[model samples]
Structures are given as C-alpha cells and as structure tokens.
Target chain A: MKRNPLVPIVVAAIIAVMLFAGIHSARKNRAARSPSVSGQVHGKDAPDFELQSLEGKNIKLSDFRGKAVLLNFWATWCGPCKIEMPWFVELQKEYGPQGFQIVGVAMDDSSTEDITKFVREMGINYPVLLGKEEVGQSYGGVNALPTSFFIDRDGKLVAREFGLQSRSVFVDHIKEALNQGQPVQAQK
Target chain B: MKRLFLCSLVLLAAAALGQDAPTMKPVVSMAPAPLTTITQGKASQVPLAFRVIRGYHINSNQPKSEFLIPTALKIGATTDIIIGGTDYPEGHDMSFAFAPDEKLNVYTGDFQVDVSVRPLRSVLPGKYMLRGNLKYQACDNAACYPPKQLPVSFEVKIAKAAPAPRKNPAQSPHSHK
Candidate 1:
C-alpha cells in the first residue's frame, strides 16, 4: 500500500493539537480538584493579601507574621457562616495572647457598613476584612461560604477548611502549625 | 457459518436482556400554598409554603457550604417584603458509598421549608412572582446521582389594606355595656 507523505504530516499536526489541548484541560481539572479551603488546609502556603478591615483599619497578611493566624472567609447571608461566627470569636479570645489571631474576610456584596453592623451584632472579636471577589479568587475562588485558612507562626500555610468547621478541628491545626517550623504543602 | 450463527444468537440474547431493564426518569414535583401575600400591618403573619415530590430532597439554603450549588430566591422588586430565614424540616440522613471508604450526607422522604414575608408598606393590588431554586445532589441507598437544580416559581396577589377600626368605637372608657 502506498501512503501519502503529506497525510502523515497532517495527521501528526492534528495529534499534536489534541495532545496540547488535553494537557491544558488536565491541568485545569487538577487545579480545580485541589482541596478547597472549606474542608482542610494542612498543606500549601496560605496565599496572602492585604485589605481594609470593616473598622477602616489597614490589615495586612505580614502584620501577623509572628502569630498563628486563622483566615476565615464568610458572608452575612450564609446561614452556616452566621452559625460559625461565634466559634471564631471564642477562639480569638482564648488564644489571642498566646500567638493566635483570627482574621475574618467577609465575602459580601453589601457595603462595609452592613458587614460592620453584622460583626457588631455578632460580637466578633477578630478583625473582619471586606473580601472582594477578585481578591478571593487569588486564594482559590471561594465556591462556598465559611472557607478558612490556617497560617502558622512562621508565616506558612498549614491547613484549609471548606465548610463550617468545629473549634477543635481548627485548634488542632493551629497548634500543629505553631509547633512546626516548616510550611505544609497540600498533596497533588 | 457456525461461528456467525453463534454471534447472532449472543446478540439476540443481549438485546432481550436490555429490554428487561427498567427505565428511569428525573422525578420533580413542586406545589405552593396560599397566603402568598399579606397587608402592611399583617405582613408578619403571612407564610409561603411548598411541597416537594416523594423520593427527592431539595437542598436547603445551606448545602455543606463547600459546593458551588447555591439555593436562590427571588421576590418582586416593588414588594416591600422582608423574607425570613428558611426553616428546613428535619429528615433521616442517609449515607452513600461514593468510594470504597467514602460517605456523603443526604436526606430522604418529605421535608418542608417555611418562608416568611412581611410588607413594610401598603402594596398596590397586583400579581407577583416568587421564585426559588434548590440545588441538591440526590442519592439512593447505594449510588449518588448527579447534582440537580430544581427551580420553583409561585404567584402572589397583593391587595389593598382593610380599613382600620374606629379609635374608641367599642372600648370607650366611660361606656357601660
């Protein structure tokens, strides 16, 4: 059988394009499969960002460099978020001086005034920041409410939780991060 | 020729077996109750009710807070209704075997969610729509089904407020009945 040389070249080009597309899509799928912050965050450097708190204070990630920080993303409209707000407040009060800090980034479309009012009503002790959608995307777009990240004293991302988490689960990660010097990386 | 005959026989048996399989269809049912609209002073007492079909549970406003499925509700722009928190009736939680050692949370049987709407001011007499979407991942005892977004729309009729009672018509301080 005689084969055309041009046919082979064209077939090779098609195969190459398909392979490239497949690889690109696979990478995107892998990124999407990475455990979202709502469930767990035992590994991965906590992506950091700076935003103004509801109190009109400049809050930065490096500001809490020497302390273990709990970064919680929540919204006023989310029922679970409201349910978990008090737990974060209690944690801040219990561990504030012992190198512990809770930072709440509210993902809400409402004005800062509304979020501040909600925080006041909830009596949250931790600093609450106004989370913008673009800013939230940098740390993995929060598909759900009550997503949280735990950073250790060494400024390493240690753990993540995707949904409403119990206080004990959060405290355990905080303790581990505080005790360990190295950052925990999320498994691929 | 014998080999070809055997292949034809096997294909016929397979087709017969396939016909014995039961067909399945997506099950969805929704119903809205009365009392959709209320007057200004009577807004706090109004209720918005729904009934879902058997063998399905709609995701409440909260669905683990990890998935992208968001429960949505829309009200008329002109209505000054204050929607209260959604209340989900408790149901038995069933487990599913997603993997060899993984389990998921789900609800089975009938459930109800109550929506309360309060009118801040007198509403112009007209018809309105209340729409809501429940995003849920349904599963039976063994296998989890694909996630579904069930949309429900209900109509409401707002009417003018009734006249108030006379200030001291019946309860006069000096009146003796």
Candidate 2:
C-alpha cells in the first residue's frame, strides 16, 4: 500500500505539541485556583490563604470563586460570634442556590477538639476552616470578634463588619453581593 | 507636703479624663464605681463588685476543667502602684452538657473580688487610676462563648500619714504660757 514512513513522524510531532500546550494551561489554572494572602485593602481583590478544614482537608480561599463568599472570623469563646452563627447557617441555605457561600475561619487558640465540638453543637452548615494569625492579617486585621468580609462574585471585597450586626444588615449586604457578577460556574 | 498636694491635683486631672470615656456594653457590670483610698505600705482591700447577666455564668479564675477558659482579673504593672494580693470568690461547681461528668468552677449572679492594693512607699499621695482588665468566658446551659476582656478602671487616692498631734505645751507644767 505505499504509506510513507514520514507520515507517522509528522503525526507524532503534532500530538506532542498539543500535549505540551495542554499541560502548560493546566498548570496555570492550578496556580490561579490557589490564591495567597498578599495584604490587599478593601475595594481591592481579597487576599487569599489556605487552611485546614475541620475534617482535616486543606481549603483555600480562592476555591470559592464564582460565588458570593462571606468570610467570617470567629472564635468559640466569642459570644457575639455565636449570636451570628445561626444567621450564617440560615443564609447559607437561603442563598446557596443563588451562588452564595459562607466560609467560616475560626481564629481560635483553642484545641481542634474544642472547636470541633462547638461546630457540632451549633449544627453549622458551611465550610469551617482554621485561620492563623497571618491569615487574619491578610483579611485586613480582624481584631474584633465576629468580623466579616463580604466578597463579590468576581472575587472583589465589597463590605466589612467589625461587630454584631442585625440579620437585616447581613441580608441587605448578601443581596448586593448576590447581584454582583454573573452566574456561578458549576462545580465538579 | 508639696508631693501630697501635687498628687491630689493629678488625681483631679485624671478624673476628668475618666469622665470623657464612654461606658462599655456590659455582659457583666462592675459595682460601687471603684473609688478608693490606699495608704502607703499598708494593704487596703479594694472590693470589686461584679453582676453577671441573668441566665449566664462565667468561668472562675481557677476553673476545675483544664479546657475551660478561666475568669481572671489582672492589675496592669506600673511603678506607681504595687498589688499586694487578691481574694477571688470561690466559683460554684457546675456540670455542662458538653461534659456532664466534669464539673467546671463558675460564677453566677453578683460576686465580689477583694483586691488588695499596697502603694509603694515611694509613691506620691495623689489620685491614680488603677488600670486593669477582667477576662472571662461566659456560658449558659446550651453553649459556651468566646472569652472577652472588659477594661477595669479604679480611681484611687493615696493620702500621706498625718503628723502626730503635738502635746499642748502651755497646759503642761513643763512649759510657760
């Protein structure tokens, strides 16, 4: 049949080039998926950090893209934080369908066992991540208990709260955050 | 004598500053407004009264459980004042849902902590603000909240010992009128 040997060589070269391009793009995607804390101010992009989840899995802030994220810093010992915990649970259920998520970062010095117990008793319905001192600083120094940051869908910081706020205040902010950007990307 | 008069003047000045400060929202309120007088080298009992919010109790300074955050009162260290000691009220033993078998020491309702202040002998007699903070972890039947620090302010005046009364010389046969 008169098939040239050079044809096989050319085919292989094309396949090699495509594979290389695909690998390069995948690496870029991973890099962008894990954002690090860089001390960005409000109106700027929210700095991100990776922390251990209550279940021991590593979680990153950038993993929450395409959704309106409520980053709340709290401790089990904080009374005000407990007062707002119920509201966050409700908000997660109400707005999650519309691409809203609550990521709780407990800036606690207590043992993981204590924190886990608190989370269990509260019946929290969202991701509970452990936050360190540097991570707290990245979110613009959450000195007060129950500090929260409202992030827009596009990953921009929108509003921040330092003390106990009424559920109405949170709902209004969530409404504004939900209205931001486009529909969220489907998760795998 | 000049030091005594000058210290009193300083105390008045500090009182004005204290007036300008806004009162904090109280989960526990201090009682009797912490105004006192302490003598140099002599320990004086400064009773600090605290009333906890109804339906809630706070962990005692020496909590029975190692994990429970203990309530504490600490006078900030300064050369102008020396803290002799403090008599914290014994916390009531109680069990919680989290750990029913483990009894934790806690305080409920109104309690008093008698803090002793011994002004350094060198300290001048004047009005001084006893700066301190009370750290406590509050809890109810259902849940335990994070620990909080309430700033403690006590205004104290240190008075100089009065000179011994001189005997009436003219009335005695030892001296002429």
Candidate 3:
C-alpha cells in the first residue's frame, strides 16, 4: 500500500483550525462573563436614566451633571447593601460640601413605603430613587447588590465596585471622582 | 500526527483554564426527586433536595430579620391532588465578612424541604405530576443577588385504598342457630 505524505498534514491542519476556534470562543466567553465595570466601560460616559425618587418626583441622572455622583444600586433584601448604607450616609455628609453627591437606586421589589421606611431608619441623607430594570440594564446589569459607580462631574464613569468593599475603597473612589470633574452648582 | 497531539493538548489546557475562572453569579440547583407513592385519601411527605453553589448562602424560610427575603416553595394548584404545607429545614446562623457583628440565618450547601401531598379518594389510581417554584435570594461574603425562582417538578404515584372489612350480619345468633 502506498502511503500519502499529505494525509497526516491535512489531519493536523484540521485539528489546528478546530483548536484555534475553540480558544477564540473561550476567550470571548470569558470576557463576556467578567463584570462590566472591570475594564469594560471605564472612562466611558455613564448611561443616563430617569427614575422616580422616594418623594414621587421624577429624577434624571443628568440632573447632577455638575457634581461628582456615586450611583449605588441596592435592594431591601440585600444584607450587604444594608451594611454599607450607613457608610454611604456618612460619606455623603463628608463629601457634600465638595460637590460630591451619592444617589441611591433601590433595586428591590419592595414597595416605596418600605424603602422609605428603610431610608428613614438608616438616616439616609441623599435622594433614594426607585430602580427600574431598564435603568439597571443600562448600567451594565446590576447583577449583585451594593454595586457602586463613581461618575465625575463631567458625567464620565471613573470607577466601579461590586459587592461590599472596604470603606477606604469608597473614600478613594470618591476623592478621585471629586478631583476629576469640574465643580458647578448641583440641581435640586 | 505529532501536531495533532499537540493541538489536543492545547485544547485541554484551555478548557482547564476556563473552568478555573471565578464565577460572580450564584447558582442553586435541585436534585431529581424520587417518585412518592401514597394511598388514596392519605398524606405522604416528598423530600426535595437542593444544593447552592459553593461560597454562597440563601436565607432560610424564616430569616432572623424581617428585611431579608426568605426562601419559600409554592406548589401549583391541581384538581386531583391537594398540596399541603411544606416543611423547611432550619438555617445555620453564620456571620459573613461584610457584617461580622450580626449573625444571619442562612442555608449553605445542601438543604431539604419536605412537602406534604394528598390525593383525593375519587382520583384515579395512576401517576400524577406536581410542579412548583422555589423562590430564593442568594448572597456570598460580600454581595447579594436578586431573588430567583427555580422551577421544580416531581411525580406522585397514587394507589387505591384497601377495601374495608365486610360487616357481619345483624342477627348473628339466629342465623347461627
């Protein structure tokens, strides 16, 4: 029997193509699985959204264009969110004078009354808006509670943190947000 | 042939690396339930096993705090079968890194829920399917995921009740004589 010299080479070529395709697909999936804030949308303009506040007033993200904003997504059922609410309150007071604003978006299914009660109990000094699914999707899917995004005064997203990070991390991000953007009068 | 072997090795290594990557999403899976057999008009307990992905915990049916969302099972209504109360296992009281001072009642790893099911006496003796949803909210050391409802289903085989003993004649003494 005569053996063909190109038989093995053709087979190897097929396997090589398959392996390359597999690796490329795996890398793409890994990137998709990663959290959006982890280098996916850094330095990009923060997605704007209009949500209803606890006071029944329509609030838009652009309303705080001149102030550095800490957009926090949380829920009543989220234990970690509860743990960080107090820290957020204190930080709000500390940075309010420096044109820094902390805006909370309640992503829970609880009623507005319940969220308001929680805010009152926690002594939340900032505006707490009722979160909508579309709004959350716009911000790259708030998969976990206590997800916070820091936007500069120019409305550019500077940083993002998932889960409950140390208070120092929040402070550092806040300082960076305050320093990066121009200071102007915050709208009511 | 050697090049083919090298390609295979590279593919295996890539798969291993992908598997080792950290997962941010929480997963809760239910094991296949064993079919429960019950006599007509009698009650039987069907145990359903569930496993939460490692490094995450969900609140039990009764959490310590009112604010926390508790896991619950709600069976769908059926015409032939009557769904009774569901019994949940007690959660372990543990503290996480986020809240070191406060202990939360949660269910980690594997847990079981016993559901009470009863078949009506008039129901035909055969297998019936039961379906429901288990609603749970999961959290890890640092973050909490939104509440999700995992679809659940199981089979129940109903058997006919044994016939009652025949009653003796009323005039037993006269009949005997």
Candidate 4:
C-alpha cells in the first residue's frame, strides 16, 4: 500500500512542534529553580553581591537595603553605556535626597587603572564597583551591556531594563521603587 | 524523503530555540573559501569573506578608541607556509542613536580580509590546510556583546616552480669540417 505524499511533511511538523514545546517547558522549569536563567528574574529578590569600589573599598548590595537601588551593569568599551553614564549621574543627584541610590557595576575586562581613568573622565557621581562573572550570573547572566535592575527599599526587584533605555524610563522606575517600600526607620 | 523530513524538523527546532535565546546566535559567520593555488616561492593573497548578523556592527581592524577591541585575524604558524601581512578593508565611520555626536569606526554587514601566503621553494607541491581565528566584538544600537573568536580554515594548493631556462651549448669546431 502506498502512503500519501503529504504524510512525511505532516509527521515532521508534528515532531518539530513537540520538540520545541518540550525544550521550552524544560527551560521554564530550569529558570524557576535557578537564578542564572534570563527572562525569568522579574519580581524576585535582587541578588546581593560584594565587589570592590574604585576607591579600594568593599561594597555589598545588602548595605543599601534601606534605600531604593538602581543596579546597572556596564562596560567601558560599550558606547551606549557611555551615553547612559551622564544621565545616571543626573538621576543619582536628583533621587539621592529621596533615599534613592544608583550603583554601577563595571563589567569590563580592562585594568583597574583604566577603569578608574574612565570613571574619572565620565565624572560619575555614583559608586562604581568592579563587576565579577559570578555576580553577573546571579542576576540572570547579563549577556548584554547596560542591564539595569530596580530594587525597592525592601530589597525586592521591581523592574529590570536591558540595553540602553530613555532617561524618562529610568526616572519612572526610580519613582516607583521609592514609593513601594518602607524606610529603615519605619522597619525598625 | 524520510531523511529530508527529519533534517527539516531539526532545523526548524533549532531556529525556534535560537530566536528565544539571542545569546546563542553567532554574530558573525565566514563564507566558504575557494582553494587558492600559488607557485612555490611566489606570494598569493587569500580573500576571506565574513558577514555580521543584521542590526549589529563590529569594530574595524583600527578602531578609533584604544578601549575598543578591534577585529583581527590571527593565523597559525607553519614552517612550510610563510604568512605575511593581512590586509583589512577600511571601516565606515558611523554614529548610532546612543552616540549621535561621535562617530565610531566600525564594520557592518559584509567585510573581507586578505591574507598573504608564500610557500617555501623546498616544500612539496600539495594541498595544505591553514587554520586561524577571527577575533571580534559586536554591538547593536544600544548594547555590546562580549568579544568572540570564530575558527577559520582554508586550503592552499602549492604548485611546483617553473624549471630553470636551458642554456644553449656552443657548437664544436669539428662539426664545421
């Protein structure tokens, strides 16, 4: 008995659909259990990390728990990151009085001297910490530069933005973070 | 027909997964190179073609900034094959939305690099495989990816050098008698 010519194509399509669904489901399960997976980190607790600041001081993300934090991952070689640096400086000054702080993680492979020179050249006002791969992994593997996460005063992740976004977007997220959580005095 | 169907299914699945994960996609790809033929002791240029994925650009061999990682080709060393200078095409100076005022020297779309190769006269005349790596960092309008190296290889057919010109012998006096 001869089979229909369209049988193979139909069977192949079905198998392809099944395989795609299976892989996607498996990835979803993995992301639920692991913090290193991207696209599934929203609304979760911001991963706390300790890194060295340009002033040769150790800073931890948990130290800023009482203040709303804007954690940004950037690189010196990234042109878009340079553009966002100035805006971040202005945002930090504007929001600092409201108990908001912006933290920069320099995910650069350049030497400390070079990064320090760049930071000085940019006139950055926020604390710029040297980024490590493990810290990046905890935040869902920041494969793209200029990734930012907004944390409320309670240390819950409120929003995350990938790549360079408009200044207004950053402002809106900052306002939301400031309004969402209680201050250290109130918690005490 | 069954084999074709299986291959099509596999490719479709891979495409779907790649779309979901942007990091899994390769930003640059090399085109298949044609085997080059060169005579012994003579230099020949091998042209390699590469294409950057849409919506991305890479720094040229000579980037304007010292901090930028420039795209470069590093060929492996071989005793029989003498590698010479690699020629890179000029980069286009373009500015993106992020940096509208300053232009960065970059390469978009398709680019080519020419490698000079010379086989020693003492080497045998045969096909030799050359291996190398193309190192580059890619970025879009707003974000940059880490630098990556793509493995490269090409075959070169070495030809024998031409025989030296034969010298004419002087005629003997006895031949005239």
Q: Pick the candidate with the highest TM-score.
A: 3
List, residue by residue over A1-188, the lDDT tens digit for candidate 1: 99788975775565566556656655544334323333344556667688998878888887877778888887765545665677777878887767788888987767888778788889998888988787778776775556778888767778776655556887787786567553333212
Name the lDDT value of residue B138 in candidate 2.
Answer: 73
Residue-by-residue lDDT tens digits, candidate 4, A1-188: 99899987896787777678767765764454322333454468898889999899999999998899999999888888899899999999999998999999999989999999999999999999999999999987888887888899989888887777899888888998898788777876
lDDT tens readout by residue for model 2, B1-177: 775576556555444333321112356778765678877667788889999987678888897645557788998977757876888999998775544566768899998888888887778899988878888877555334456788887878897856557985566655554
The sequence of per-residue lDDT tens digits that candidate 1 reaches over residues B1-177 is 775576556555444433321112343444555646566545443343444345444344454434323334444334465566555554443332212233223344445556666555555666766666655544332222334556766666666777776685566666665
Task: Give the residue spans of candidate 4 off by over 4 A.
Answer: A1-42, B1-23, B163-177
Estimate the lDDT of model 4: 0.87
lDDT of 2 at B129: 84
True contacts kept of 2: 0.01
Candidate 3 C-alpha error for residue B142, in Å: 1.2
Q: Which regions in candidate 1 have their CA more than 4 angstroms from the true location? A: A1-43, A182-188, B1-177
The digit string of per-residue lDDT tens for model 3 on B1-177 reads: 776677678768656544533345547889999989999999999999999988889999999988899999999999978999899999999999988999999999999999999998988999999999999999888888889999999999999999767997588666677
Give lDDT: candidate 1, residue A188: 23
Highest DockQ: give the candidate number. 3
DockQ of each: 0.03, 0.01, 0.37, 0.23
Q: In model 2, which runs have C-alpha deviations exceeding 4 angstroms?
A: A1-42, A186-188, B1-68, B73-87, B90-177
Off by over 4 Å in 3: A1-38, A185-188, B1-26, B166-177
Q: Candidate 2: give the clashing pairs.
A: A77-B145, A77-B146, A78-B146, B7-B126
